[model samples]
Target: MLSFNSVSSRVLQTLNSTFNFTATRHACKITSIHAITSMKTQPNQVNHSVELGNRRKCLLDRPGLFGIKRGMITWFNDNGRQFPATVIEIDSVEVIKHKTEQEFGYTSVMVGAVDKLKNVNNLKLFEQAGVSPKHKLGEFRVRSETGLVPVGAELKADMFAVGQMVDIKGITKGKGFAGVMKRHGFKGLAATHGVSKAHRKQGATGGNQDPGRVLPGKKMAGRMGGRSSTEMNLEVLHADGDAGILVVKGCIPGPNKAYVKITDSVKLYGKSIESIERD
Candidate 1:
């Protein structure tokens, strides 16, 4: 069995030669945010992804729930087998607003991604949030009574440690206008004799009308994907503070360079942020 050091060394070396990168274990730096980036940035954008695989399990205490973030993958375990990991880039998340119980009705912090937009409308919204012109914004509520991150404070990658379990939330790729078979996993009508145009259709909307018409939420499909998704308890493979990169142990939702909301695993440990090591 290979040790963690061996796995890290082999993977990084293979990655350096293939991508012409100067990355090491401690200094695994990536300039490009695209997953599976080329030595030079490519002209045509491709949705390259990182693949995850099974690893030896180790227990850990959950970290503080950080708010919404955006990230992309930079490496892969296989071409795409078993576990598909994501190398989430920490793009300088800064707090913009905070809602206290006294002020509003709940306690939560609103954070925005590093400002990259210059549009007037966007800047106006950013001003209200108390941050500079940011591209995207998201909010987070603490699970239990705890200290709040002051508005304008920046969120770092080191808030999470290697081996901790995290929950990643993001939008899945849009499939757009799908049938019931693909969207809701409904077994289609008979695909043989007598089946004309009802192959991939959801049969029987309403049989008898004791309650009348097609029920409100019947198993039929129009649109698919393009919605929020969450993958729980993805193990943190490697976490670097200086480089602001995180490699997790399983697949995350959405296309490359999609916005993601990462937090402490609610499924793993539903606790307060008491052991958060703030910088």
Candidate 2:
């Protein structure tokens, strides 16, 4: 008699072969075996699972690109809490041109925002954008190298949807020269009893013995703000395609008239929120 282990191994092998043969025969019956064979030989053909998985991953890693504008904050209001403000409008963005991998070593679309004829003296750039003139032009990189996105392709608030999260990137408001207490948030010396002029000072920067020199990033008093920053997970309150306006909830960096770039949020808490535009 055959050994028990060998018999079990053979049984498993036979079962696997039988299952595969049954599946192949069933598929062939549904569609002729010629069709199956053709699909197998086709170039760039992939299984449904593989195709679906790749699509899913692409959806998850949605590209976030930058945009620029020179518009005022229109309006804002506090909702009574740590989070304040509702709605911001960054208007019409027209696609000027696209950069290809051959020329730029990457694919990206160049968009023009906030028209200002006085500053934009380049008449050719205006002619290309199909607009009078623009104060700012921005470029955003995408995943693929699909030719120019079509000159004059208008982008509006409709590109994003309400209830979806987004990442807002902008330069923070500049705060000129500042003290350590205001800039680096250092707890200065006590205000009472012999504290003297050292009240706002950064105190002992380094110890006497060890290390001998001050640390590189010692957080001393200096210029503050005016740096690129990102505010994540800001909810889009509304999108008006006709008006080319986007209403985003929560505060954004920068002053009233500062420019900012908005993109789909990299991280989201709930299930992937599909936009109505996709449907």
Candidate 3:
């Protein structure tokens, strides 16, 4: 009979040999499988879904909402019946100050327009604003509070780009007291037949018995024009960076040289350059 120690050593060697044989067979099987898969896969049919998904995610994660405020418009000339204008340049608009809910009980950005000359009565105001000598100064209220925009931070026409639509706010040209024929689009009396001073007069304001007085808010002609108006979706034609001018296509709300507030357009169709490009 074999000794106990010799028997144990023989058993261990046998186990090692069986393990090595099984491992070698498994390795050969794995290698063959890999070669078959490589041969089956076509180079031109490589999967790109992962890369495409990453790119889509990157675009969706873009930060911040970029848009302009309302009440701004661009101006241009009308050739025949067609209007043509472009937005060129807008001055550097800076946030001089802000109003917080805790202090002023509201959130607003105090945007200063052109500065004005100092007046003796408004000495303190001039000192507070620290604005240079200018002809006019106005404050524009923003919808929400923004980051701290330091004084002297000038805004440029590039804030807006070509093909953008803006809303313009201005006082309409005054027509004083106008007649019904001119103001309310009344047909007026017959030109030739029995017609006298009653030509432009409002025909019949009220009935005989039902209502004695003329109804309130009736479209009678008293005064026309000279009121605040907002024109929307004026296309930005060109932007002159150095000159700080924005040439827009078509007529704006106010007369030439009149002060107007230019803001982002409220109309859904008119907004950014991308939207215009699509149209």
Lowest lDDT 10-residue stretch of candidate 3: 58-67
Per-prediction TM-score = 0.64, 0.64, 0.59
Clashing pairs in 2: none
Write model 3 residue lDDT over 42-137, tens digit each, in one string.
Answer: 468434553333222212110111122223353443464445453322444444555554576444445544455455344445456575433434
Runs in model 2 with CA error above 4 Å?
Answer: 1-83, 146-148, 268-279
- Residues 182-236 of candidate 2 have per-residue lDDT tens digits of 9988889999988887888888888778888898988888999999998989877
Model 2: how far residue 187 lies from native, Å:
1.9
lDDT of candidate 2 at residue 64, scale 0 to 100: 33
Better of 2 and 3 by lDDT: 2
Instruction: Give the lowest summed-lDDT range of ten residues in model 1.
Output: 50-59
Better of 2 and 3 by TM-score: 2
> Which numbered prediction scores highest in lDDT against the true structure?
1
lDDT, each prediction? 0.68, 0.65, 0.55
Best of the two (1, 3) by TM-score: 1
